[model samples]
Target: MRKLVIAISMLAFTGAAASADPIADRQALMKERGKLVGTLSKVVKGEQAFDAAAVLDALKGLEANAEKFDTEALFPVGSEQGRDTTAAPKIWEDKAGFNAAEDKFLADVKAAVAAPPADVDALKGPFGTIAKDCGACHQTYRIKKG
Candidate 1:
């Protein structure tokens, strides 16, 4: 029993010390973005009350993630192979275009943060634009999982 406990502790420590893979990092970032966007959507659709502080926090999270998307190092070559990544090959094939798309997303998120919507009705336009941009990128750069 003592030997088994020691082995389990070693395993847990190793797992904790392991470095994160880039694809995994990106996937986690995207998941965070999705959660933030989902929360904002609820606010925009009248399902939740429009709180300026919450809206700002969500938008700021999106903006920070958008900027991270611009980092060339984040999408290192061959990073997509081992993981269950949704990233498309074209992201590396046409790196410039991918970067451009990321730049546009960053700009859009920054703009939204700068001039946040006052109410649910007012949020519709800007939120729609952000959603459109996300869809465009996903359509072009993300592969649908089976």
Candidate 2:
């Protein structure tokens, strides 16, 4: 009975938390996304001090943000109404592939961020590889809303 009560309380709490605040949520996500891209760009261009520790930290943040983008709450059903959302409908259809892409993106970014080039000046190869995964997913899943 105690366990059941705890579970019920947890579920209620989670349900309350799941209520969407679309604007704030999107803003927060976009902020993190921009930070991730900015950090990656700096490392790639040798503009920032390429500390492996710092890179790993940024990568972890990026991965967590990426995972959050996978949640249904963010892309709620029937949310395709005039919100500038770039998510294509095919994402739901190709759920497995979309999920796999997200997973691969996280893993690739993690590895690349964790094992960044010792010689920061010549980071073209590693950075380009990581960027490729991002582009690949965008090409398939993200809509070009021009």
Candidate 3:
């Protein structure tokens, strides 16, 4: 019963926290992706010992965010102007291209998740590919923060 109460409370808190602030919500989502990538990067760079479970979890998170990137609500109109968003105005200007970039990212993430690496060495290629996808999207759609 205690566990159930805690779980319910956490859910309620999360729901309230998410709110209607699309910029904040999307920023939070991107931060989560960054953290997952950082975790995998540590393993890849030999800063951390290879952990298959952790690698798989991070891949799953990346895949989930890739899917979320497609959701229209995640980038509501006018969301780019306010908040500390790195999203560039070009995203709204070139909506089709922005969505195409997201689609490519989703496909790359799906491929990585589908064949999770068994070791850090094995992860290097797919991880690099996903990183490239992120860079490509960021180059076109995201503004650099000063």
Give each model a TM-score: 0.83, 0.67, 0.85
Q: Mind sharing the TM-score for model 1?
A: 0.83
Q: For residues 1-146, could you state the per-residue lDDT of candidate 1 as single tens digits?
A: 32443344345333433645677567656776787789889998789999876787777778766765534666888876775788999898988988888888888889988998787777788789889888998999999999
Off by over 4 Å in 1: 1-20
Best by lDDT: 3
Candidate 2 lDDT score relative to the true structure: 0.63
Q: Evaluate all candidate structures by whole-model CA lDDT and list the values in order.
A: 0.75, 0.63, 0.77
lDDT of 3 by residue, 1-146 (tens): 32443344345435634797777667766776787789888998999999887788778777766665544787878787886788898888998898888888788888988888999889999999888888898999999988
Per-residue lDDT, model 3, residue 1, is 33
As for candidate 3, its clashing pairs are none
Off by over 4 Å in 3: 1-17
**Candidate 2 local lDDT, residue 14:** 45
Candidate with more favorable, higher TM-score: 2 or 3: 3
Candidate 2 segments whose C-alpha is farther than 4 A from its true place: 1-19, 22-27, 113-117, 121-126
Candidate with best TM-score: 3
The superposed Cα distance between candidate 3 and the true structure at residue 58, in angstroms, equals: 0.8
